[model samples]
Target chain A: MDCTIVKIGGSIIDSPEQLQRFLQDFASISGAKILVHGGGVMASRLQKALGQQPVMVDGRRVTDEQALKAVVMVYAGWCGKNIVAGLQSLGCSAIGVSGADADLIRAVRRAPVPVDYGYVGDITPESINTDFLTLLLRAGITPVFCAVTHDGCGQLLNTNADTVASCLAAALAQTGHISLTYCFEKDGVLYDKDDDSSVIPEISSGMYRSLRSEGRIAAGMIPKLDNAFAALRNGVSEITVTHARSLLSGKGTKIIL
Target chain B: MDCTIVKIGGSIIDSPEQLQRFLQDFASISGAKILVHGGGVMASRLQKALGQQPVMVDGRRVTDEQALKAVVMVYAGWCGKNIVAGLQSLGCSAIGVSGADADLIRAVRRAPVPVDYGYVGDITPESINTDFLTLLLRAGITPVFCAVTHDGCGQLLNTNADTVASCLAAALAQTGHISLTYCFEKDGVLYDKDDDSSVIPEISSGMYRSLRSEGRIAAGMIPKLDNAFAALRNGVSEITVTHARSLLSGKGTKIIL
Candidate 1:
C-alpha cells in the first residue's frame, strides 16, 4: 500500500527550471502513487496584467465573474498541462484533475457574508470519493489535481491548495504512505519566518495552539498546519511540511500527535 | 443593435498562421459586438499523445474525469491564452471563458448509453447568462469562448463549437446581430467537397434539410448545419458559414429562413 500524496505549490511552479528538476526527481520514485495540488499564481499574475487588482478577504481571492474565468483559464489550462507535460517527458503517466471531474472535490461556496468575495469556495469532505483515487493509483497513474472545486451547482470555484492537499492526503492516508507538502520559500516548519534557526524539527498537537497563541505560526502556514494536524488526528499516519529540495534530504518538520 | 457573434472553427485554430490572419481581420471589424468560439484540435491532439483515446457517443466527445482536466489545460491554458495574445497584439481586449465560469453554459450529463463514450454530456441553455457578454461588448471587449460546459452537477463536459456559437447567437439575437462561423479550408460553403465550384451561395432551411437527406453533409459538417439552422430558428437575423478570411469579404453561404 505504498501510496504518497505530494502537493506542488504555485510559488515554485513559476520557475520552469525548478519544475523540470522536480519532475525528474518525481519520476525516479517508483512503487508509489502520487497526487498533485497546484495554485493560481499564474492566473493571479494575469489579473494584475489585465488591470484587475485582486481583492482578497481572509486568504481567499475575491473571484468576481471575470476573475473566476481568468483563474479557470490559467489554472486548468496553463498550470495543469505544463505539469502533465513535465511528467510525460519523464515517461510517467500523469493525469490532470479539477473538482468538477466526477465531482472529485465537492465544495461549499463561501458566500463571504462580510466581504462579498463572489465565487470563492470551501471543500466539503463528505463529497470526496477516495475510491476514484484508489482506482487511479491502482492503475499506476499519477493524478495531478488543481486547486479548483465545484460548488455542486454547475459553477466551479477557486480553492486553497493547502486545503486541497490536505483533503487528498486524508483521502489516501489509509494506504500507509505519508503526506508531503513542498513549498519553495520556506525551510521546514520554522518557528518564525524571520528566523530560520528557530525552525522546529517536530511539533505535537498540544504545542500547536500555544504556538498560535504566541503568534509563532501565521499567514498561509497557519491553515496548512491546521489541516495537517486535522489529517493526523483523523487517522492519517504522518504528515511533513518542508522545502522541495529538502524533502529528499530528510530536512523537513514532521507533524505528530 | 449591432452585435455579431463570430465563431472561429477548430481547423483554423490548428494552424498558427491561419489563426494570426484571422486575428488581424478580427481587429479590422468595428462597430459590432464580437464573440469568439474556439475548438479543441490542439487539446484533442495532446489527449491522443497521452494515450487516452477520446470517448465519443453520438457525435460529441465524452470528457471523462481525466480528459476534462486535459481539455481545461489545453483549451483554456494553451489555446485560449495564445489566441487572446494574438488578438491583443492587434489591439483587441479578448477574454477567455469556459463553461464552469459563472455557469456560462450549463449542462446535463447524459448517461453513458453510447457504449464507448465514458462521460459525455449535453448543454442546458437556460443556464447561460448573456449579462457577462453584454457587459464585455458594452466595454468593447471581445469575449472568446471555449466549447466546454458545466453539467450543473459538478461536471465539465465537452460540447460542440457550433452548438456554443448557435447558443450565443440566439442569446445575442435580441440586438439584431448576425452569427458568422469561420472555417479555414474552403472559400465558401461547398455543395460538394470534391468540386470547389459546387459552392452554395445561399441555403434555406429546406435546402439544408435536403442536403442532409442526400447525405451531402456528413460527420463534422452535420453539426455545423444543424447549429446554423438552430440559430436562425431561435432568433439570429442571419448566419454565415464560410472561410475566416471571407468573413469581411462576404464570400460564404448565407443561411436564412
Candidate 2:
C-alpha cells in the first residue's frame, strides 16, 4: 500500500557489487511500490569508449545526434537493464520505460542558444502522465527508469537520471508516496561535498538553494538538490537524500519544503 | 572548395537499397566535402522481431538500456559499416564515428518526467570538435556519422539524424557549406503532406513555425524544421530540405533566415 520513489545516482552505484548490494536492500521492500532513476556515470564511461566527447551547458547535456545515441546505449542497455536484472535477481518484477512511452514526458525542443547546443529539450510538466506511474504501482511492478526521453516522433533526448526521478516523484507525489534519492557516496544529504562527515540532517528548499548559490554543491549534487526541491514543491512527502544502505535506518537529509 | 552536410532520415535511408542510392550519389559528388548521418530503422525492425515494441515520443525513439544495446549492434556493427562499405565501393575514403569516437558531441544526461526514460542526453556545444570534422574534410575523406553522441564522461544519446546533420553543418558552416537534409519520400518540401507534387519553394523560420503551429507540419517534418532552424541559427550559410535525388537540381525547399 506504500510507495517510495528512489533515485540512484551514477557515482555511488558504479559497479555490479554496489548495484547488487542495493538490490538486496530493494528486495526487502517487496510489498512497497518502488520507482527508480539511474544512469549518467556509466553513460560517461561508454561515451569515452566510443570516442564521442560530451558537451554540457548549465549542468544539462547538449545531447547532439551522436551523444544522444550514446545515451540510448548507456542508459537503456547498460544502466537500465542491469538494475532491472539486479532487482529481478532479488525477486522484484521490473519494467523499464523511457520518457517517449505513453508520452510520459512531453518536452519542447530547446533551440541552440548561448552556444548552439543542439537538440536539447525542456520539460513540459502539463504533458507528464502521473496516472501511468499509479497504474504501474497499482499493478505492483517496480518501474525502473533511465534518463532518455523522446520528442514524440522518434528522436530520443538525453535527460538527467536524477532529474527524471525528481520529476516523476513530483508528478506522482499526489499519490502520497515517500520519495528517496540514492547516490553511492556518503550517508545522505551533506552540508559539503568534500567533507563526508558534514552530513546535513535535513535540507529546506530555501537553504538548499543558498548552498548552491554559495558554490557549496557542485558536480552531480546540484541537480539532485534542484530536483528534490521541485519534487517537494510538487507535493512529494518525506524525501530522503542518502545512500541505499541508509534507507533501512531512515537516515539521510530529510528534504523539506 | 565546397562542403555539403547530408542528413539521412530514419524512414528513407533505412533500407539497403535506399542507402546504396544515397551513397552512389555521394560518391559522385566531385571535390565536395560530405558528412553523412545514419540511424537504424533496420535495427528497430529487428528489435520489433524480438517482441519489444519500439517506444517513441514526439518523433524521437526512446533508446532505453535494451534498445541502446540493440542499436550499438545495429548502428556501429550494422548501419555504420554498411554505409562505410558502400562509400568504399564507390571509391571514396569513408570513416565512421559514433558519439564515442571523437568526443564529437559532449552532452549531459536528461531526466525522465512521465516515464523512466533511460540514458538520453543533451548536447553541450562547447565540447564539439570542429577540428575533427575539418581534418576529415581536409584529408578528402567522407565522414559517415552514426546518430549517436557522447556525454563528456562516456555516455551516448540516441539523437535524430536530422539534428545531427544540422549540428555538423552548423559547426562547419563557416567554411561555406550547404546543409542538405534528405529523406526518401518525395523529391522536395511539400505544401501539404498528402500531395507529393506540392513542392514548396522556400520556408523562412517564421513560416515554418506557423505551419508547425497550425499542424501543417508533423511527423518527419518536425525534426527537419527543428534542425533547419538550428542550422540557420548556428551560422550555416544555407540549408536545403529535400529528397536524395533532388540534391543535384537544388529542387528541395530552401530554408532561409
Q: Best candidate, DockQ-wise?
A: 1
Locate the minimum summed-lDDT window of 10 residues in model 2 chain B.
Answer: B76-85
Q: Which stretches of model 2 miss by more than 4 angstroms?
A: B1-257
What's model 1's overall lDDT?
0.68
Model 2 per-residue lDDT at A114: 68
Off by over 4 Å in 1: B1-257
Query: Against the correct fold, how does model 1 do in TM-score?
Result: 0.56
lDDT values, one for every candidate: 0.68, 0.65
Each candidate's B-chain TM-score, in sequence, is 0.91, 0.91
The TM-scores, one per candidate, come to: 0.56, 0.52
Identify the CAPRI category of the predicted complex in candidate 2: incorrect
**Candidate 1 lDDT by residue in tens digits, A1-257:** 56666777777788877777766777677765565656567777767755678777667688897687667666767676556646655666565666664356768888667778787778744556576556556656677777766665446677887788777777666666665554555777778868876778898888888888898885778878888887786667767787765656567788998
C-alpha root-mean-square deviation, candidate 1: 15.6
Predicted structure with the largest TM-score when compared to the true one: 1
